[model samples]
Target: MTTKPAIIILSASVLAMASRVASDLGGEVHGFGKRVPDGADVTFDDVAAHLAGLFQERRPMVAVMAAGAVIRLLAPHLGDKLREPPVVALAEDGSAVVPLLGGHHGANVMARRIAGVVNGFAAITTAGDIRFGVALDQPPEGWALANPGSAKEVMADLVAGASARIEGNAPWLAGSSLSLAEDGEIDLITSDAADAAPGRGLLYRPKRLVLGIGCERGCETGEVLALARESLSEAGLSPQAVGLVASIDVKADEAALHHVARYFDCPVRFFDAARLEAETPRLRNPSDIVFAEVGCHGVAEGAALASVGASGELVAAKRKSGRATCAISRAQQPFTESNLPGRSRGRLFVVGIGPGSDGWRSPEVTQMVSRATDLVGYSLYLDLLGPLANGKTRHDFDLGKEEARVRHAMELAGEGRSVALVCSGDAGIYAMATLVFELLDKADGPDGLRDGARRIEIAVSPGISALQAAAARAGAPLGHDFCTISLSDLLTPWEDIKRRVSAAGEGDFVIAFYNPVSKKRRTQLAWARDKLLEHRPVSCPVILAANLGREGETIRVVPLGELDVDDVDMLTVVVVGSSNSSTVKTGDGRTWVYTPRGYARKEGTAMTNTIPGDAA
Candidate 1:
């Protein structure tokens, strides 16, 4: 399950001591209200309750108290929800502030904001946050511990209450950017706009910015920050106004955690692991392992969500990845009373069409397409769904132009237009569902876009992938532990593909191969076979299934060594079995394939009747 970001606020003296505890539990702390002596022990229930209550109301609040008051008033509220406010306790000497709740959820955020007034540490807990000093819940919604080393300076600035000017659509501004100045005396500026007058805080909002991050298996803090810099440079945005950081979740403990937290001076939100399994919206023709597992969808969604305003549209579906797609609203305010119908809200669908045949297309997908005012996809994919796209505005582009298509789709959806992005086979399986989330991650467009975008609703439906169709055609070859691999090398390198294939082979797992061959990519299959031969016997059964649910469908079985590569193409699927596979040729020359259950002998008790009958 994905972990939610949290924050903790407490009084100052207690804050100094509790900071370690909060960080140990992966939280940040803020000290507020009265200050207490150092090393004082306090009960934390009341503070905890108040925070829970605040969260329930979706209101940003933090509890403040002194160290003595913590044990007296705060301790009682721990078990009950206290609106889940950001809680912070201050010390009498004004030396420290401790955040005890909602650390990532804003406790530390509140603490740092206050720290500027009092001149103290925000007391962030996570090792990466403390060392690099980042607030976990700041910006870049999907970045976590993947890069923990880069947060030092960012957190320091926030603690100092340095004036921060926001340039682009800042979701943290709530409804009005101007209101931010009123609430916190912060200034907002444009990317190219001149810096604020001396003594004023500056936040430069560039028209575009990207934060790319790379980390070790558990990424470090500095590396995460370095990657963020790289992405910002690539996107032509200043590092100062980076609104968010985006990265995979597996490295949540690495430098990415601190780097992004400090960079945005905001919380680091984590994406769903299943969602991150895929690639981002801008990526196409991903590597074989990417398609075989989750594709680029999650990365795209994380990027879009982090960059885009809170109110964005999920313009595309997950494609070739478990990752999702999203688009930011370019609008400036809430969308209301627009010329468009349906409450001026947008909608997103992760539609799945079973297999490639039109007959297998789900009714929901067909309905969504028919109701859509616009369509988005690669030219070939759009053409495939042309029948359902009559009268709809089409955002058609080349095979690899995914980002452009997503941007266009979000713009339309934000305008309150219903739209559907087409995907072949299941939208979730190497399809378009994940891209919708990626686009949403960075949706910080105009006011109309923001208002309607936040109102967008998203849904996903199930569909049959090629593996299932191929397996059924080949007589239940997928009944056991099986894995799927795409031979395509668009996004993944051949080295990674080889490793996965080798692992699956060594594990004695059944395998399904998709995109086995294309006109330009022929050697992958041959290479795969050679690798598999290293583990399995020459006589291993290989089922070649072509056009399984479509016309000209054919299923053939051959020995691993005897299989012919020329007979396979992009449309063909190969299911290679383990040593248990066997073929039974019927007397009539027809052949049936089967795998033994491996069941042993059965024993039972029997009663004798002959003796009893003779006696009777």
Candidate 2:
């Protein structure tokens, strides 16, 4: 069904005529002047060479030949390598442009484009023919065909000389719209009736959806959006393709959710939290707090899936503000098995291998690795898991090249293999799990990865992240409300990083910074410290853990004012404690770090009840 454009010339005379027509039609022409005029004995070799030249230059070309004869001559050469050309046969009198090949591959469209220049008519085939309309299958870049069958029907109507009615949510398509003749024998209709005449087409459907979601607490909205996209991708849908956004009632006031809704340029409809809870499919390992507060699984994935009903399915889920937010869209069409992984079902595990150490690696993660058919990760990560990846197919790339690694893993898993994409810490924490869903959301179409019948399961097994381990090793600096930030500007911009640091400092929150500094990126950490100093005291405790849980590891604490930016590198994690965090020196001259229990009064009261001297 894939179409390509090409040009076929039946004879020397026809080739010469086509060259003249191409020039008049505003297309670059080749291959007619070198041969004898009126020569009908043209070989397939000559035709193919000219066609190949056009394709090599990435331009659309048409072949001039009789339909039946051209198919016979080119059938043997019609393998994938032929690079389809727009085939237009002359009818002795050049009245029409016929697109025999690549009807959708730009041949038919190109013919029309050229026909306008040559003052000729293009013979297009498809339904929903309107004087001016865009093909459903051929949406603009960044937009996807939500319904291809409908698109084909519309195009077929157009080719049958019928006109169409066009409607859209926005006026973006007006300028680039195609044209049909005023008297093209087509009618426009607004009704969705099936009995509408050949020329009648309806552009608007009120049932088309737009979903907006919000969450409680501090759940990251970006993560939720990623999950929602995954679900939509699984159903072969797009955010832009939906008419409205359906989200939880609680998120109606969330700034982040509003930001996303604005970006999508859609209306947000909030549903009752109870309704969302009632509709959410029960998961065995639901986060308790999420279920209790949101009356459902609070992940955007669950909410979006529920809001869309069975039609939209689940695309994303994330916990925010003690509640979960999700966005849902109605499924456009039924997906096929070919759209999913080739096998019956497949599993994608986002495993956090744990701060580059086997000892800290969870047993569940080890088992998952051992059971996997393929292992995908950075080369260093793959090397770290070499012992566990003995029999598995390894797909190793470079550090910071996570997108490619995740893509390769998805491709393998799409083929029905049990694949695991590796990450350094908790898979859910700044790891492959989120990226996997993001990629799924942004997939172009339902091409062998949208089948709902095939199981596309993903799970994240928690492993100790550097921040957690570093905090534990350096005492209880993380015993209170805290947050983790990455100083690496690879994904997030520096402005965002600075803003987050400033926010955390103002909130008096402990901050764990990953990717603190590298050879090329030295100033960010210094900038971050200066921002933090705005809200924190000079003597605030800052713990630095370098090569944590690895050979040549170092864990030390320094005052915020004394922190040396030069000492940090990619492998270092910096933990900046709140102003209240302090250091205690033991009699043995070893320094330990601790944050006040905040329950000191209660502890003192307990001591008084037990022993009098202990109270002092």
Candidate 3:
């Protein structure tokens, strides 16, 4: 199942440690302080209020603070232990982990899971867990208890050494520590319902039922809900055993169907008509009306049978109300998100993670990376994702394998997996986004290597490009009309790059040069500098910012005449000023570079302590 992410709340003092802790647990980290670390996925101003909100929403949380502080902040909102989300408190030093609330709902289990990561002690105080090493009330994963209020008395009897008899077939009962007998006073019936006497063992319901629903447009939510309950009741099926609600994709936005799913608190799945129609031979009620209207033989019955796969049997056929129809099917195994029908036809996320700094990375990029099942990028770019890439299948390539990387991402996405193609700076600017489109456009070539590339869903999320970072570092060199040009002749001819540089220089546009120089290509930056000197004065301000927003970063403004090729490298972005660009010295003795944007011509908007006037 696609479980909700845990909320890891951290104080300012332990922001870094908490970020690592959240990444290790694959949870979202929320920081509370004046200046929390950038590693925190969320930041909050009020700790007490936010904690209360999380509690009200029933979101599982791990507060990285003293247990006493967590208790003080959360005590007011605590109610209904059975319905509450797990709240675990950890020491700032990671020495102790305590399950403060919802031990059965998963706080104790979460604490022990985190203890394995942080190498700390899980202070579990539950009596059943301490003695039996299992929660009798909380059924195993994927199993739901029909009536949990009945668990207390049965657990008490078991604790008092009462013998019990297993009445139904279940794999879990075989290995359980329950005192079993052929005929006992306490009967542990594991069937769909409890058929034994009133005061008996628990009714642990396996999630084996799949409810398929179809509704007319604008159907009432109440009618859909009523029909669903009636169908299950008529089939002698327990409503608690329903695991999935499936329908045709055409009904994905149907409010009535979704309302029924919300009532059950189960995921609503949508299958395409093609997938639903494939089960026509197995469908008990193949409707010509449904086939003509929705291009499917059956929606309700077909969706249910499709969800449970070939081994499943339809227990309840289609039952209709005034506006909706419902069906139920039983599966040999419980339905999970992974095995659900109508899987999405892959998505390719072209993400740009900024210049290797955690703080500079965009939140959208982080979210995309977290959701991606496959991460395809260069080795260094993948490393920049750090702990976020822990569970994702990493397809790391060397620096020169751009085509291979793009192809791998597209193929994985074609296979219906969420894939992220990572780029260093902005994916759209001198990055992978353009290459992805180019490959898509050229897929019908002689080699036919990129067939079906156009069908996959693609998205490009912008990031802080190297030129933007350089301009920001140099104090707004890109304030006016400017253009970016890469000097590398790897793809484009050197003669073409030289012409573009000359044209940009002649037009007096502030130019940012990318891929300026390398070990073999040493003189491109110098050659471009000489061309810019023709249009701008020898004393024009030129900002050479290397490794901007990353380690060992440096930003310096030099005269056009004093531009040095030896100091420039492929990693540096050289932002050359226009002829009208001016530099002003700040009080701290650092130079600020900016170009005029004609604000001087307007009234009462003159630039002060900075460069002013239009180039004209």
Candidate 4:
């Protein structure tokens, strides 16, 4: 079941109260403007527009304000009651709580829950809910409604003293509070796809089936989708009951098989040939030819039984189309992550979190961190993430242990765990990504690494580097040409650093210096400044930015001659301009720095601008 996140909106006056409610309710908080609550994850400008968008997206919302404000903003989007998301309104001081929409679709339940959080009263007005203590249309978790249109009539009959019949083997039917009689006019049937018997009845579908699929290369995806749907319909199975799709690892990239999985809205699992061949003794119709070709007796049936584990049984034998095959299995136990070892492929994500701010962090980095089973980074860098790193296994290392950190992350991934190796700036920019690839190259059979480390899948997610951050702070300093040089000789020799700095000066490139000067290495920045002075004049602009996108940030533009060697530190990025770069003061009395692209020279002679040899 997918639990949609709830959004709590409040004005600045009641931000503290709303923050308390939102925290207790376990959802995201959104404030109107400045002076937002301290715990708000996001802030917005226009309340009406944001609320309407939330309504359209069908996300549950709790508005801590007058009920009229919510209703007026949501009136234009008020269409379907059954499909609409839950909407609740509460008083600022926790007095009254009301369900404004989606009463049957969890609004009433959410209202009561929020009321409990606020120590107030829930105003539930639905008649069936007050009488029967359950919503007829909305089934319990892991249950789907076959036809939602019949819920209203059945609820009406039940509320009007009409007896109901429970005509299925579902255990939930025994605990239902509805008036169930041996023979009654209204029927409630629990089935995979049981049809109506000339009367009003609600069909509740349970998730209990797993579909296994195998397809040839270049097979049409539409054919597999249609055949799978037809087989489910013929077997009296609801598409909603599909738990997963299983296949062999060799067919992991088969398009048709994945398409069928998507149509059923189920996860796809693949088993290696060794695991599949282990199940040959249990095959109903084992083929020697198939075993010889793919090392498996059967792909569909073997994958099905393997995915459902030891207690499951094959309900449908393997059925074939022109270029595809599928089978269905029923599990004795509930489907869960424990039954998902058939698809445990190792993956390692090397990511950069950018500077230490929520605003500067990319969405991809957050998602990678949240999905990772292990996080490996410097101790200080890990501490910057705060609550986002909660509940994950942290492998913190001191600085200068980059090789050990990347190796540990890869070892975890080799054990079939998802690992994220975090860096501060961009991962590819003097970060751990290169070290990961280097370790993989050397892990061939030596260097005391696990044999599986070479096979773990790896990906690099880029982030905003410190040079880009510094350039953005000082407007357009890198507009023409630029090159970055790290002054640290810990990795590279000092002779090479001096050569690169000298080359950058001769080339007249806008130089962005990273790792400018550390505690022990104080002479490199001064040497580079003297070297650059040989090409550009003393009055050239130089922008010094330190701690970009983080606390204690500062940006100062100074003349090249006044470039303070004492002020430069390891955390500072110095961007020195070229000969064409200049500064101008705007109407707001702020200095802006930019390098001209030589278009001004042409603009000054625009009237006489002509191509050479254009005369007759």
Candidate 5:
């Protein structure tokens, strides 16, 4: 969604207009079914539900429908304007653009942008935007309003024939239409220091302050945050005036520094030790211990001066708590995200795509993948991403080399790149999550893990595993106790696999078999079937689910005695039900499987024909 907005339309007649707008704005077209156009990105059946869901998910939307319809659809969810995403209502011909909600937040900006693309009219209705050409509540980027409670009052005062004077060097305020005089009754002050406030006025803050932090590895979050607050308070600097939190690159994955950045709602940027060492001459409080540790004369003050450039100097010297250090510097100019140099500490997301289907993919996974700059996975798994992998730099390893791909992903992210180590199904369940941690456990020792690899943050996103998908596609075969076993015996010993299977058989657990068979490994699946028959009856249900959520998918229920190894493959998960499992024939001529969780025993319907065609 960062690249493509969701462009929703109702009919094929409007498809041409939608396509033009989509191309012009770099958005994807989503439409209702049947009437959905051939070139649409996605299609849905229900309009109201789809609109409500998109609003709930906070996806940026441009609906090609009547304003009343969209208003009625989203009016129930209009409480928090700050959290709402831009929702623009476009004319069917792409002529007029109206922002029904989130006008100042982002909708007005998007409306004007779209109108510019199509040479259309963007309806501006907000009084402050229309009269003064600015939203007092929402200032331009790199500027923060210190006293937001005064915005409504100041706007009203200006409307009622009051003149204001700007004391600071704010070009945006000077360019607005507010009445001004040499000495006016209302004061609109803009300064980086908190002490610049007059007796009574609206205080606007330029984001010129930089807070440079250096903390011990694995320090507590509260210690760094408290030191930051105390440093700003002691320096008479507003926290709103801070634009960046600078730190050394080695501590990029440190949680304490990140917590301080989050507290100020500012970005955290990192500098390598060499870069920090360059600013040693400007450091007011240089240290020899730090020089010996990280090859920098100082960390907190050196990073602050390095961030603010040569023209700026540190306003507050090195201030430290027990394990954390803090310093403040005023930049020569307000620093925006674009104007800031350097990169973030990289992140590696160990994601599970849930059987290679977009519909089965979680929203969290989709959002994270969109933010990734690189992807590392198998060729077929990367191909399954479809449109999501369009702009990504993919490093597709062959199916055999799992360790090689993980190593590649870690290295890329260690270089300050956003990387995703893609895996199929749940990454934790017999997948790459364990391998990533195992590598991290013995990192920077012998094998290929560099020292920077330890500085990259790792997050694991869960997905529906093969066993869960098979159980859902068939019935509830895993209602009570369930366990999974991989039969490949490639990395694991066959003796250990046999012991687990025999123990699970004694435990009466419904067994889900993964990696059922391969071309050369066909005997294990047959041996497991024969061994499981020793405990349960031959009539026990066994589900063979192949290609679970992808094309050419198949699900079959057969008896335990009739289990065939030829029908099972790496893509298939074979689930052998327990003794209490039952197979039922519905009136619709379809089959369903269920294992009673003893609810039927208490309800006195254990073996009764309560269902229409359930076998007794």
Candidate 6:
């Protein structure tokens, strides 16, 4: 489940309330309708479909609407409560906060939190949380409920005027109004577990255990997980009590460490060498070689001890599996996202925002941009991110300097900050993604790649390209075989570009031209147009789509003989159709340009291509 919530609002009136809630909760606001509201971080038209999609993605939602409306809309998608994320509904005027679903699984708590933001009453319907001041089944972070099935029964009795007494250490639960007494009618059991069943009452496991792991570069995930389980078994410790996974900062990008954290269902924290070195005295098995290599005596033990702070003690000695090590430390208290020090693995998303329109952009790209702590991109592209970059630290650059912009994003991500390198079109298609991979492929010399930048996690999200947006605007102009060529000779030789254009002409392919023209370079588009005309007919359609999917969008279709260079601009993507391509007037008198992939000739040019008696 995503920690960040999506605040969804229907109209412009509730936008103030939505933004206020977003400010307090650190969530992105989604405005639904034709024209996106000014303050919305994201926009969607179809509320039902969008909510279903968000629900399936397991994203926590705070819809600023009636609670009954939300319940009715999501009732069809609701099923097993265990897998659902929190879903809360808020009044349009910010007067009431209600958790419509997932009460025990965080909705109630989220509702209360939202209520605090608006100074409104939390209409928490969950009887347990209302009476006990906590979600009994869903414990707080760094803790787990072993016997969730017993919570309802236990809370029922407690709410029925019965008192309880704890069987083990649970300082975290001291604040909850669970009606406890010295000699209580019921019991609340706690254990540092080893697959043991509860003897009596509701069983809860506090996150007092820390799982520390160290592995060689590119270590197998299974091996690391096996060692963790083995180490836990050896120490007779419960994986449930393992609150956090700790590792050296150098291993921040290690897939094995992340997988082990997933296995324990805990957050992983990375410690710098200096921090780990300070914990050298607490290490059960300090190593000179480790100190020489990573400037730390021991990665596993030091990281574990450092996570638990001054009161922590090593409960399990360093255990090794071929290329990995594991150690356990018991903390005096449980862990949380706030209390845990040291950086987490940095994340870099090379995402394409698509042709300056929310409708054209993918949801994934928007989500990534919202989640990003920093956005690095050219000035115009950064402006295209709209409200998603509202509170983010934008590292904006000029039109040129692509290399510097990407490098800065990597460096920021290496500092454990989530960074998004924004691009206009598809990231992989003649964009900054290639530059990112090239930089990563370089040797890790001092002047080359930095250690932190090299170890950050990077992801590339596909965006609607200029070619796609142009083709879509011109109906099905790219229905047949197509090839794209960038007319700019800055990267490739002009001769090489001409050769590719000539080859595309010979192939009779629908061609999409990127970087067709610029202020200083206007002749390339005319030259390419003439080149394609040599192989295709003079009557062939040439689509000049300027500022596709952006404001003042223009789509001009002209025959090859009448194609004008002056009509195109730097933002234009010129598509030259194949010889077989044609334009036709639809029933509504709307014109469409399409290159048929021989569906007509193969079936004798008849509208019906099926055999006789075949179902239509």
* Highest-scoring model, TM-score: 6
In terms of lDDT, model 4 sits at: 0.77
Best to worst by TM-score, what's the order? 6, 5, 4, 3, 2, 1
Please identify which of the two predictions, 2 or 4, would achieve the higher lDDT against the true structure.
Answer: 4
How does each model score on TM-score?
A: 0.40, 0.42, 0.64, 0.77, 0.91, 0.93
Q: Give the runs in model 3 whose Cα sits over 4 Å from its true position.
A: 1-64, 68-85, 92-96, 100-105, 112-207, 211-242, 245-311, 316-328, 337-345, 440-459, 489-508, 518-531, 586-589, 596-616
- Ranking 5 against 6 by lDDT, winner: 6
lDDT of 6 by residue, 1-616 (tens): 2468889998888788788888888887889856455778889989999999899888889998888889888989998889888899898777888887788777887888888888888998888778778777787776788887787787787889998887788765677888889888777777777756554477778887888888999999999999999999998888788888999998998899999888888889999999999998777789999999999999999998998899889999899999999999988878887787678889999999889788888988987887888999999999987887798898989988999988999999999999999999899999999999889988365557788999989899999999998888889987777999999999899999999998998777789999988889989888888887777778888888888887888988899888888888888889998777789888997677998756332211212332222232
Q: Predict model 6's lDDT versus the native.
A: 0.85
TM-score of 6: 0.93
lDDT of 1 by residue, 1-616 (tens): 0121223344454465345444443333323223432222222234445444434544443333454554455454455432354556655444676766556555665567656655666666644245334442243232222222333443355455543444455453333222233444444334422233223333423323223232344445555555454444444434444333444443333444555657665333334334444334434322344335434344534434433334443222222211222221121222222211111235555566565455566545655664566777777666655335544677787866766666666666655566676666677777667766766665565422343444355666666777777666666665446788887888778888989998888765678888889899989999989888776677778888886666688888888888778989877888887655566786887555555444111121121221111121
Task: Output the lDDT of residue 590, model 2.
Answer: 65
Ranking by lDDT: 6, 5, 3, 4, 2, 1
Query: Which segments of candidate 6 are over 4 A away from where they belong?
Result: 116-119, 168-172, 193-197, 445-447, 586-590, 599-616
lDDT of 3 by residue, 544-598 (tens): 8887777799998899999999888878889898776789999999899988785
Give the winner by lDDT: 1 or 6. Answer: 6
| Clash numbers, per candidate | 175, 64, 0, 0, 0, 0
lDDT of 5 by residue, 1-616 (tens): 3535788998988887777777777677787866863556666677888788778878889999999999999888788877787799998877899988877766787788889876789997888777877777778789988887777788787777888888889888899998889798888888888765555568888998889999898999999999999999999888889898999989888888888888888888899999999998888888999999999998899889889898887999989999999999888888885788567888898999899876677766766676789999999888877767766899999988999889889989998888888888988998888888988988957784887787898989998899999999988998777899999799999999999998877666789999989889999989888888877778889999999899899999999989988877778889998767789988998688888765222121123322222344
Show the colliding residue pairs in model 6. Answer: none
Please give the distance, in angstroms, between residue 600's alpha carbon in candidate 4 and its true position after superposition: 4.9
Worst 10 residues of 2 by lDDT: 604-613
- Clashing residue pairs, candidate 5? none
**Which TM-score value belongs to model 4?**
0.77
